[model samples]
Target: MRAVIATEPGGPEVLTVAELPDPEAGPGEVVLDVAAAGLNRADLLQRMGFYPPPPGASDVMGMECSGTVAAVGPDVEGWSVGDRACALLAGGGYATKVAVPAGQLMPIPDGVDLVTAAALPEVACTVWSNVFMVAGLQPGEAFLVHGGAGGIGTMAIQLASELGAKVFTTGGTAEKLAACAALGADVTINYRDEDFVEVIREVTDGRGVDVILDNMGAKYLGRNVDTLATEGRLVIIGMQGGTRAELDINALLRKRGAIIATTLRSRPTAEKSAICASVVEHVWPLVAEGLVQPIVHGTMPLAEARAAHALMESGDHMGKILLTT
Candidate 1:
């Protein structure tokens, strides 16, 4: 099988196509004939040597994939060869074939194409688990998402809106913010030109938002606490901004706030499977009903994984970037 490998940690230049042995399904796992794969910010981080795959994970890049089941291992049931499915993985997506736990597999929702299905698992699991499962964003409550035009942000906005939350988001430019608004964001703030904390406070009548989905770690820590309601929750999924910043403990205490940070990729297989199972049961119907759809910015060949990485870094894309095998 041909897959992209990071020869060394650096730029996109480090990515190259290499022929590797095809992975076989282990107990409770399935082997997929890869059709399409999704590119994520974490993919770039892993390529730059800052993020390594968890124990027993593939060295190849790719977090989620949509493909057909080529084979299934022992103890797996309810699926068979040739099932059209998408799956979340720890790694090895940029290839013609990869193996994943059967529990992590999700049947492709009716009416969604294989390529688009590739774009769903990562963002869906990330947003659903963080915003709803962890933060517990409630209907009629204010929800703020940073990087509004991103795959994670776009999904978050739609999911929160579908659940009847008042959604707000921050982007770097007017166009990005507009895109966010079109995706059901009630308030869109240009973080470059406006103070999001102040804007969020003003929009919430000075009470602050009920929940904030953040990727900017240390940089937004203080401001996030400042823009929280009396019992608000801040969920951190990434650290795009610098990871070191001073914290105001008093602010958190005064607001009776909570801060939670996690990465889905590094989780144990059992945990990831549990999350995927929940998504399959609950969120899959939303896609099937056409209430939410995968927002794909572009697709490239698997061999051009480097170019995919370059496009993601440019920050010009509005949604998910995909790589097809």
Candidate 2:
């Protein structure tokens, strides 16, 4: 097997691919001959040594991949060699092969090809678990997601719209905002020129939004709270902005709003499996029906993972970037 590793904690230049021994499946796990791996913000953080995998997970940077099952461990069931699947992983996805817990594997939605399936696991599981499962976003509610043209944002826009929420998103450029609107964003704010809080406030007739999926962390915290409707939920999944911030408890109390900060990478396996199962049940049907879809920007060879990381860091690409084996 071949894998990408950071020679040192620094820039994308530190990444290098090297030959390594193939991983063996453990109890209740399976090994995949990877078809493609998805680039994520977390992968860049891992490469820079800010986010390490949980204990015993491989040091590879990827958190999701699509592949064929190559081996299954004892106690694993309902999967076998040659099974085509996409997987959520704790690590080890930036390789030609990876070991995944059996429960985290998902069948490809009808009509999605093998490689594009790599784009679904992380975004689907993250959005479904955080927005619907935890935040309890319901039909007729208003929803907002930051970075509307990125991997998670695109998926969030489509899913929230398809599920009957009035979707709102923030993007930096005309092209990106247009894309988000086409993907069903009812309101698109140019974060550079317009304040999302004001835009959301005006569009919701000052009721504000029922839910907000924020990635900017501290940079948007105060405003996010201001934008939330009474009893609204704000879920923060990334700290792309600086982490530390002061909270306005009195303001939150007035609205009875809730704020939650979470990460998908560090979740317990059983919890992740449950999220995957729920996604299959609730999200896959919409995907198969063509009401929701994966947004892939482009593909690069697995060996060029360094370039892929650079592209993501540049923040110039729209949608998910994949590394194909």
Candidate 3:
């Protein structure tokens, strides 16, 4: 099997395709002949030595993939060889073969092809868990998501809008904002030119948003707090804007808002499995019905993962960049 391995902690140039041993399924797991892998900011961070895989996990730099089952291990049920599925992986997705826990596998949605399904698991689980399960975004409530044209943001906007939430998103350019609007975002703010907090206030008659899916951590912390409606929930999943910041305890207390920081990679397998199940149950139907769709910017060969990383780093893509076998 050929896998993308980082030679050292540095730039994307350090990533190289090399032959590696094929993975075998362990108990309650399945071995997938990977068709494609999704590129994410976390992968770039890992390549740069900022993020490491959890203990006892693969060192490869991918978090999600779609493929056919090549083999199944003992105790696994309802899946077999040749089943078309996508999985939320802890690591090892940038390879021809990967062993995945059965619980982390989802049958490809009815209308999605195998290659495109690679882009779904990560964004689906991330948005469904944070926005719906954790933040408890309700129909008719206002929702805000930063980085509205990226993978998670695109999915979040569609899912929230389809479920009846008034969706607002921030992007850096007109093209990106336009893409977000076409995906069902009701309000699009150019973060570089506008104050999103003020926009949210004006759009909602100063009520603020009930739920926010934030990727910028410290930099947006204060503003996110200011933009939240009373009893609002803000879930932070990434730290593109740095990690440390001062929080206004008084403002939070006055609004009765909650700030939660979470990461999907370090979670226990059981929790990941539960999230995958929930996504399949609640989100897959929307996808199957064409109410939501995978937003892939482009696909590259697995050996060209370095270029894919470069593209992500350049911020030139509207959605996911996929690496195909």
Candidate 4:
């Protein structure tokens, strides 16, 4: 098997391809012949030594992949060799072969290709778990998302709209916001030009949004609270802008709002599998119907993982960057 390994913590240049032994499925697990892998911010972080793989998990950097089942472990049911699937992984997706718990594997939705299926597991699971499961975005209510053109943002906009939420999002450019709007955002704020808090307030007649999906943690913390309706939920999934911040507890109490911060990769296997199961049952049909398609920015060969990382760092992509085997 061929796998991308980071020899040391540095730039993407440190990533290299090497021959590795094929991984075998353990109890309740399945070995996948990885067809494609999707890039995430965490992949870059792990490559540079900021985030490490979970304890007792694969050392590889990828967190999600789409492929065919090459083998199934003892006691694993509901899946078998040759099943087309995508899976959310604890780690080890950046390879020709990787093993994942069977519960984490989702059958590829009808009409979706193997490579495109790679793009869905992470974004679908992330958006479903955070925006719907945790934050409880409701139909006809205002929903705001930061990083509106990234993979998670693109998926969030579509899924939120499909579920009937009036979506709002912040991007760095007019083109980016336009792309987000095309995906179903009712209000698009250019964070570089407009104050999103003010824009969101003005758009909603000063009442504020009912739910906000944020990736800029510390930087947007104060304003996020300012742009929330009573009982509004703020779900923070990433800290791209910085981590530490000052918050006004009184303001939050006044709004009767709640803030939640979570990461999918760090979750326990059982919880992740549960999220995967629900997404397969509920969201996969949307893909099958073409109502919620994964937006792929580009596909690059797996050996050029550094170039993929460079493209993500440039912030020029409108959706996902995929690495194919």
Which one is best on lDDT?
3
Tens digits of per-residue lDDT for model 2 on 1-325?
9999999999999999999999999999999999999999999988899999999899888999999999999999899899999999999999999999998999999999999999999999999999999999999999999999999999999999999999999999999999999999998999999998888878778999999999999999999999999999999999998898999999999999999988888889999999999999999999999999999999999889889999999999999999999
Q: Cα lDDT of model 4 overall?
A: 0.93
Clashing pairs in 1: none
Q: Of 1 and 3, which scores higher on TM-score?
A: 3
lDDT at 14 for candidate 1?
96
- Regions more than 4 Å wrong, model 2: none
TM-score of 1: 0.99
Query: For residues 79-153, what per-residue lDDT tens digits would candidate 4 score against the true structure?
Result: 978999999998888899999999899999999999999999999999999999898888899999999899999
lDDT for residue 32 in candidate 2, whole number 0-100: 97
Count the clashes in each prediction: 0, 0, 0, 0
Q: In model 4, state the lDDT of residue 143.
A: 96
Q: Clashing pairs in model 3?
A: none
Model 1, 237-261: lDDT tens digits are 9999878888888889998999998
Reference-based TM-score of each model: 0.99, 0.99, 0.99, 0.99
Q: lDDT ranking from best to worst? A: 3, 2, 4, 1
Q: Return the lDDT, model 4, position 77.
A: 93
